[model samples]
Target: MGVIKGIEHVGITVPSIEAAERFFQQAFGAKTLYALIEKGGKSQEGDEMYDKNGLEPGTRIIAMRMMRIADGANVELFEVEGGHGATADAPSHMGIHHFALYVDDLEEAAARFRDAGGTMREGPIELGGKEKGPGNRCWFGVAPWGMQVEFIHLPSPIALDDQASSGPRWLPG
Candidate 1:
């Protein structure tokens, strides 16, 4: 195996790429970086690739739209055409469950997300302890595409410890 770089971006499946583009702009202050409509391209989970193949006479992904969270990573949206492939939804499918983003101000981030029609699922978890360490973490209600996003404020650099089974138990401090 090779050393891995950080996450580049996440792709999301949408019925309408245009709708997703608009929603990201309005809801999360995301900006559109690039978009293209490939008449005949390789079909991906969110993309519709069209070609005259064995299964169908001609099947393909007609269009795709990609947006980014400001200067951050991007979210590629695909608008697949029928007969190309079946579109899968969240829960059962194997895709991105949530992308964790680090923010400076938790209050402001939450407010902005909510004001822009976002819903909050988890809370401002004060993450700090001798064992757990210090930080703030929470999960967004849902993205415009119904995907979950997490906002975390880490006090210090930390990594997940697989050996650490249970958290420190409180003894009525």
Candidate 2:
């Protein structure tokens, strides 16, 4: 099998593309790369396709914006006019729990997030020693639309030991 490359982007469904774009830009200095709009119809075939994809029939993708966050990954923010899904309130729910961004200054990042109307959900906690060493810290914030965002500061990447579990090495630190 071919080896997989790194992640290119993460898609996030938001209530409003404009608001999400603004939040990302203000909080993380994310820049918009592109935008798109997808139209939906109520035809039988269209409805079937939408239903198969867990979307409401005739649901339209109102707007979508691809944003680049600092020097890390890209985030694709989508605004669907009609979708048959609900946002998960907590990280324990079975789905994409949250997305994290790395920052040099944890306090500054948290302040920017708060200034952008995001609520601090948890932590300005430390993770040292066996967890991820002395230089790592993190905090979680929720956007106005209830999307969870994590801000982390790690001056050095953690080196996994032989006893480490099989998962994303960059995560859970």
Candidate 3:
């Protein structure tokens, strides 16, 4: 619909927003866009926010931040009390999976991630098949906060992309 532009941001609950901020800054050069939000009755504002935002009852948010990485989608990080997702998830779970970052140089981006304490599981090899076509490469990895991340380089449109997506696929030049 014309009302929807595109992905505004993605929100994730981390064990510590401070650590998450550092990791994103070091790895992807994410710039903080705003101040942190601390919940749990620090002010009546927090309570009002929780109810309006559909937060879990008694959810104690230590901090939440808004960050922008490059010109792509923004990221919203939440640090909650007693959260257990301080490590990357193994064996894969349901719901939203990895977020792939479109990179000009997969090796260089992966290197930055590695330097910032991320881990990969091989690949970056050329992708083959009708949909992926040739010259497209992908590298899968785990973020410092244990989220799955991918560095993908798609030089051109994949096969049947026009039929699959609602709009034109967004890619970096």
Candidate 4:
């Protein structure tokens, strides 16, 4: 894909950034790197921030924190003054429904998720085809901050590897 490299980070909006950071830390060992816009406020004049960022009028950027989980994409949590925290109940909902994380041990991650106040879907549903490979168990859960997340563990490469152009997807180290 040329020298475009890859995604550096994914921005997520949360109502309570403190809780979000704590949840990610306790659930997945996410480490906070630094703060970008440490303070949250409006542009105060000409709706500059809103019009410039294409944000709705009066949407103030509360705060932002950069984080890393293993070697995956950096997680940027954004706290906005007018942001509404909506939790999705199904994967088919509109927009980006969820983000998946690779785990070496699904059970341990689930335990941490539960301990962090996340409500996980019942059963560690095992995939039945070669697409997901063998010994692959996928579990879905809601983060304490109302974000939907998936934890997947694949013991071996999936059959889809043969049909890929990007080779194998990146896994956390």
Candidate 5:
């Protein structure tokens, strides 16, 4: 059996914890649950444990704040000491540059993000161009760490439908 239940949290490195906190609060209705200004880094054992999932040592994650979302998942905001993230000039500069947050309303989410001092980079348009389903999605304010946060409002009927449909029609064998 898989040894995983669900995601505990996702660390997001940012420049300012307060700013990021405010943005998340407005954008996704996230509330701050805890905060810490850690020096150096986390414990070696802790690092090792998390490393299995993709954490590493020597990273200068200065400040961290945990926020509680409506779905019970925790969003950990990490503010790194040095500048670490994609730059506006180089959009393709890889690494964890963005994360999508599923929201109920697109316009409301975008408005809240702007009100909370976050900048919207692109449209609340239909994604999955020329695809099967109507993937209505939207992009939002850049994070302090220079990552883009997208607010995705997927189709409700498909999301809630319980009936399973056939995968793909048979092909000539």
Candidate 6:
């Protein structure tokens, strides 16, 4: 098996890249690195690029923006003009459940997210016991395009087994 390094970026389809960029900037202080638009060509259909990805023949990537989050994760916002597939129903969906954004203040972040046009879907509730760490709080919010985003505040370091070869190193120090 090939050894995997780490996540380079996460791609999310949005109705409008501008709106998504505004929300990310206002809510999470994300910075937009760049934006681009891709036009479909002959190779987009009939066993070509678009056909292989289930996109329509002349599907156009109307708007795309690459933004860097606080923790250095790059979020690629795509606005496809002729894409195929419906947004996941969330929480109950079989695919990606949600993408989490770790913050220092969960409550404040949730409030900002709401102010930035995000709808709160679940709690600012604390995790029970020590399964997640003391006082760790989490909240779920839905983006304008129906994507679920989670905000979490975990101040305590997670305990790892001594025999474990490697542990997660993505958390902010």
Best candidate per lDDT, number?
Answer: 4
- The global C-alpha lDDT for each of the candidates, from Candidate 1 onward, is 0.58, 0.69, 0.71, 0.72, 0.60, 0.67
Model 4 misplaced stretches (Cα beyond 4 Å) = 40-46, 50-52, 83-96, 128-130, 161-164
Better by TM-score, candidate 3 or 2: 3
Itemize residue pairs with steric clashes in candidate 6.
none
Per-residue C-alpha lDDT of model 1 across residues 88-117, encoded as one tens digit per residue? 442113236677666776788777777766
lDDT of 3 at 75: 87
Q: Which structure is stronger by lDDT: 3 or 4?
A: 4
* Model 6 TM-score, all chains together: 0.76
Task: Give the better candidate number (4 or 6) by TM-score.
Answer: 4
Looking at candidate 2, the ten consecutive residues that score lowest on lDDT are: 86-95
TM-score of 1: 0.62
lDDT of 4 at 84: 44
TM-score, structure 2 vs. true: 0.74
- lDDT by residue (32-140, candidate 5, tens digit) is 8887655455622224433453333333455678898777468887665433433432111222557667777788888877776677876866666432256556666
Please provide TM-scores, in order, for all candidate models, with all chains considered together.
Answer: 0.62, 0.74, 0.79, 0.80, 0.64, 0.76
**Candidate 1 wrongly placed segments (more than 4 Å):** 1-4, 38-60, 83-95, 128-131, 159-173
Worst 10-residue lDDT window for candidate 5 reads: 86-95
Off by over 4 Å in 6: 1-3, 38-47, 51-58, 86-96, 128-130, 159-163
Question: Least lDDT summed over 10 consecutive residues: which range in candidate 1?
Answer: 46-55
In candidate 1 the C-alpha lDDT for residue 69 amounts to 80
Q: Which is the winner by lDDT between candidate 3 and candidate 6?
A: 3
Clashing pairs in 2: none
lDDT score for residue 56 of model 2:
49
TM-score order of candidates, best first? 4, 3, 6, 2, 5, 1
